[model samples]
Target chain A: MKKSIILFIALLGLASVAYANESQIWGEMRIQNILGYGQEESLKLGVLFTMLQSKYFAWVFLGVLLGVPLVFFLHYKIVGPKVFPHSHKKHYAFNLFHRTVHQIAAVSFLVLLPTGFIIVFGDFFGGGTLVRMAKNLHGLFTIPFAIVVIPMALMWLKEALFNLEDVKWFMILGGYLSKEKQIINATQFNAGQKMWYWVAILGGITMILSGAFMFFLDFKMEMLHNITGLSQIDLLRVAAILHNVMGFAVVALFITHVYMSMFAIKGAVYSIITGYVEEEEVKILHNAWYKKLKEKGKF
Target chain B: MSNEMSRMKFFCDDHRCIECFACSVACAEAHELPTGISRRKVITLFDGIEGKEVSTSIACMHCTDAPCEQVCPVDCFYIREDGIVLHDKEKCIGCGYCLYACPFGAPQFPRDGAFGAKGAMDKCTMCAGGPLETNSEKERHLYGQNRIAEGKVPMCAAVCSTNALLVGDAESVSTIYRKRVAGRGKGA
Candidate 1:
């Protein structure tokens, strides 16, 4: 952490010549005016938006959407699946409410990600009826995801918070780098899972907000003028930029979450599906939680 | 020959504009646009602020390097040889990326989406119709008028009370603007 802080400070001071080679102050200023911030301009944010939209967003999104799966394929080939023997003994992990919320979030994500990509690389499909259908489907799925996102955050907030043991879990990369059955320091949810929780819930909310702005073009940004200080047009620009940036993170993290849940640990999905975990699987993968349960005589 | 093959353009002189909405109204009436759609709009900045007030009419402008063409997901926008930027309404998904990209806010989406979001895009076609055969009934209904093919000036410029809006060959348009500025003693 000390080294990271020092490096961060060093990088900050390394270049005093702070100027955007990719100038887009006008766009950012417009956004500031719309969101009711009343600022002169968001120079850096505009530069970033201009750079992303003009050149990088397509390539970066393409890389993440396609590259992540290729990476999982290699990982699977090397480490193979960690299959724990099924014992009739089980522990209830998710209740009906939890399972229902998870399903809603999952199904919405499944629809949104593909349709979002189709909209991103819209011209690839020749900008016709097919892409339009994807655009519509993308908007429709936002409703379900929006409903469950807050609940998902509230339910998982405690487990998703970082603990000292999570640092150790990170060092070993959650024991997935090797094909060995290791008693990991993770509780029910590991550091990686915690990261996914924040990105999905929090990032999902921001996407909903920004998507709403773009979705309902007629929705007035006037009342928000004093608070956000952005013109309506510029606010839309910021929303579009933010939505794309969030897409990059969500796509990468969501793919990892899916792969870990379904493929990395065989039969791991049973917990989510039936709200029961195999006794042996819990004892090995989540020893910390397993020990607590055992102490309480729940095991 | 130059007017036919050269770049077409629009220039809205703010000093001459009266904020009467005549250009916008002429555009809609001539094209028989829907209740809310305005192909040309007059914006008054600092309205009623005495000397600070300034108004200008704006439309597609048909930019040579249009940003909407760049960000469009469906590649709907195309530039004609005469430099009129047009889009095929059939291919438009109404996703509104063009609305975000446009500096002028030219692209307008009807609230006709699958949800209450949007439908296919509607925007200034520079009086030039879409990919359909020029002046067809379907083209007229989907994209308004095909006045460019009819060998007439776009109605917005034609009916401008103050001649604040002008559209034609680039050279002619600039010459007119230069003349206006010189007469106003604002040009060197």
Candidate 2:
């Protein structure tokens, strides 16, 4: 009888702890552990949140915001653009559907980057209607990006995959390091483009999902606990960390992609809009793709 | 009057708190708060005792180094000389960063935008109002009454029957805490 009574009392003891008791001690209530700091995960998350709010994220962003543009400026000044004719025989590269999706994603990203930077360096603008508007637009623009992200991924997935030819492309920097146009062997998408494609699609999806957690604040912790064994606040910490880390990657790659299209290779930006690749430029820059077309007797 | 210049703070005496929603009700009524907003809440801290209950009132403790101020992207928060943390509603984009950083869960948001998007952040202003002109019509409209400007205690503390919710200078509050601890023949 004593053993059975002890067993029943032990179950009762376990029940109290399982009932979401804020205090870890069986009877003592700790004021410090109230609210968000109630669990060990909550405590660790608090520390992370503090580090995030401090100059840590800002200093890292400063490197990207200041450091990247300087490299681009140097590249522009020294190497010069690979100039190509705008009007030429259209070597059909992208279709109307592909062009439309690319344009929408590009425009959305164009808005997202600046606004997101504004949010990252928010203290500079000193909060008001402008930052608030930026915040709202950031969420609003996510819709278009989210809609096109999947299609964009599937369309470019096969071409964006890396192969041995890409190794050679990476070695010579895709023949973009010099002024003189050199014939380069690159597949439909070069090594640089393949890297960009993965970053934009995968990193963008992670950023979107993480941003959603912050946007919708009313989602219950219990539901999240059932899924991730974490409280809502802990999940939020993870989201914020993921979002910021992905933001860094997206920002870096987006800048590179923009530079490669608009400045590094002249008239390349127009191809996305016009849905045509310059045949002469493709022959020089995409030698492998040009060879494939020649073998097929298309050119 | 001189005490107003000291760093302002709140100390809820956990021992005496009765969980009577007086402070919360008084704050809501005094501020004419929106339906979903409450600046002060009494929460039960311990329920292990068979019949006795220990509870405490919680709100924005208005920390010396306020985390909300640190995390706000818009630089909306500004601490006064007396250490009461305040923010500009006009500048707040309602991004909810401050909400995440605040351990107390002090920042409150009214669902104003479409699909329940957060409006400007609202929290315990410590009866000091916001960045607008003191006690002006616009200030009152945006941030409720400015009791501090009128030389009065915050409404919640003023109405606290058990004196559990203490609000004053840090030194004064700590002195009282020390006295209460000594009176109980123990230390917190």
Candidate 3:
């Protein structure tokens, strides 16, 4: 009875949180007027209605706030060192590509995250000396950040493709959450990790595209004019929403990925940082690849 | 007050508009609007429709109840006592809600700011002063054609060669319209 009551209370709390982030009343009225009525009415109802639909940033924030601690607790308590102990075998060859990609991703994401946040919250927190400084920094760093993100996306392109093994790995929860060690013969990156990689790349591309369009509104791009069929003002409004959504999505993914790597899987952090792992841990986690590398005398 | 309201409205005669874009160019020139930003445009609907193609000069309606004023996040838009809806360029963040809400595609933005930054919105303000102090140079440069204060009609209405465009109070303008419709009756 107590457990059921606790669950009920938790559900209610979640329901309230969901309701709190609802779009405004006027936005609802506008949507109804648009979908049910004619274009004339919809145009009269105006762009404010569309702005309400672009509040994905709120969801991204909630996902991170809840997902981070939950992942950490699950990793430490439920699936700690008992499942996967620290490895010391130093399998450097297998991790070389992974390590390089991880570093680039980390750096690019670090820059993107803060710049994104500043852009969103600039209205409230703007005009301060510190915020002005941060804005300058954000503008400066975004150039290199954009440069690295493109290559990072291309590097992970092959692994993100959907394959039969990826499907099976997904069906079995990537054999990470489930205690079935036999199902662990998955591909280079597990299904869950691959999903994260794909989202990062796709979401990153959206941010870059929208951000670029917004930054160059002054240029006479006849193509853009024809495509949106909107005045320059409308284009900027659309860009703002896209940039905000992608920014939040990237932040949420980063938090979850970090928690899983650093605290969830024992010794997962060490491999990336040191480029080495114990022989026993490798044999347990990645036996097939480990044995092949060893036979080739590449490790 | 009726005379004041007369300066806030615009009308185009469908019969006289030749779809030549002369009025559109005149509006832009009157405002000194920057390149690629047009406060007024000619929308030619139904091209080659066997005498049914309609060309209308579109700009701000200066609506009795403007939606742009209601939806602006910064409260940048204001309706003058004469009912002309004008916005403060300095306060505008280039969000474009006004462009979306406007029924006539009156609001325009410069496309040359850093990062495609939307410059402040420019639109037909019924030839009235914006939120700036009355008759200020800043107001003249940003809004353009402040004919309301000069006791004259708007440039678009004045420059209309065929006298197709009219600007005045709702009742008087509608009366003129009814007279025109009545004059064309009985196939005479």
The prediction achieving the highest DockQ against the true structure is 2
- Residues B1-188 of candidate 3: C-alpha lDDT, one tens digit per residue: 45554545777777667777777788778878886666666666666897788666767778886766755544577777667888877666565555545544456666443444455667787778687777788888878867878998887777777777777877677677778778886211
Q: Rate residue A283 of model 1 by lDDT.
A: 83
Report the CAPRI category for model 3.
Answer: incorrect
Query: Residue A211 of model 1: what lDDT?
Result: 86
Each model's TM-score?
0.88, 0.87, 0.63
Ranking of candidates on TM-score, top first: 1, 2, 3
Docking class of 1: acceptable
Q: Best to worst by DockQ, what's the order?
A: 2, 1, 3
State the C-alpha lDDT per candidate: 0.78, 0.80, 0.60
Please list the residue runs of candidate 1 whose C-alpha ends up more than 4 Å from where it truly belongs after superposition.
A1-51, A221-223, B1-5
Worst ten in a row by lDDT for model 1 chain A: A15-24
**Local accuracy of candidate 1 as per-residue lDDT tens digits, B61-135:** 787777778777778888998999999888888977776666565777666666555788888887888899889
Residue-wise C-alpha lDDT for candidate 1, range A101-134, written one tens digit per residue: 9999999999999998888888888877888899
| Candidate whose lDDT is highest | 2
Worst 10 residues of 3 chain A by lDDT: A22-31
